[model samples]
Target: MAGPPRPAQPRPVWFEAAADGTIQLFTPSDSVKLRRPRRDPRASIVVAAPPGERERRVSVTGQTTVEAEGARDLAERLAARYWDLDERADDLAAMVADELIRIVRHPERVRRFAF
Candidate 1:
């Protein structure tokens, strides 16, 4: 496969799905998770709703592309979603500009389950 190999252990992450259905994820530029995708453009993402509810989840197997140019923009969106970035926009933007990496996954298959 041209994608990243399954990790020895699962690493949970926060992700956002766009209206177009592609998934967006942000991680540190030096993260192992980012390394795998850079080596191989394939990736899989699993997301669960209402945390701790395994039965309600969505899994996406796809191809990923590193989007360095848009990393700062994506980071800003993420910060707005997860934190109060209004007052600290400059700081947050600087941090993301320096260390963040954006991974955009184009879904090949999507599976959802409700149990």
Candidate 2:
């Protein structure tokens, strides 16, 4: 017999690119589902950096690879480089291990604004 459905686990948030080039972020929970959809190369991934008190937005865009795992690791790396936050790949992955539905995206759409 089949086993009971497993409960959803916490996962790191990630943005994805659609065929139309629109961006979408997977919630920490909704990532439990797999085989949902892979990002299209034609599109781009936009990562919005937290704004400072002065008021400004930082965005980065670069080519990305598609993968079904290793999302948290990616997040950690991004955080370190962009946010100057030191994070471990293992711990990052572990934090979202329960909802380890990984997908890779490379940012190609980028923009910034300062006030």
Candidate 3:
């Protein structure tokens, strides 16, 4: 017999490489912090928009290094990459700076699926 399926959750958060080689993650309260997993020091990323029914997604898993930095800066860089806009970069960056932190992970393992 097979078990029930698992629930969907956010996975493979984005993290860019800072001047230094480190990874980062944001807190629910809009605070930047390190998402260092005691068991799994590595990290993974799934860079695809949330899909609806009958949709598909592409993702990759790899090793990661957590970088320690102020939240504000990290958010902006992520926004710029995701949005690809230059104007109001600072403002937009500031908005999510606290929302996300940076993570430096390598593409060691990759997996894709359709739903």
User: Can you give the TM-score per candidate against the true fold?
Assistant: 0.75, 0.36, 0.44
Which candidate ranks first by TM-score, i.e. highest?
1
lDDT of 3 by residue, 15-114 (tens): 5654644344443343332434333455555655465556666566667554445655666566667775766667674566444434455566767887
Ranking by TM-score: 1, 3, 2
Question: Candidate 1 — worst ten consecutive residues by lDDT sum?
Answer: 1-10
lDDT (CA) per prediction? 0.78, 0.47, 0.54
What's the lDDT for residue 53 in model 2?
A: 61
- What candidate 2 gets wrong by more than 4 Å, as runs, is 1-52, 60-65, 72-99
- Give a tens-digit lDDT track for model 2, residues 34-64: 3223322333333344655676664545543
Model 1 C-alpha lDDT versus the unseen true structure: 0.78
Q: Which run of 10 residues does model 3 get worst, by summed lDDT?
A: 30-39
TM-score of 2: 0.36
Candidate 1, pairs of clashing residues = none
Clashes of each: 0, 2, 9
- Residue-level lDDT tens digits of model 1 in 1-115: 3555566436866577889888988887887777778877877877777767556888889899888666677777777887777788887867775777888999999999988
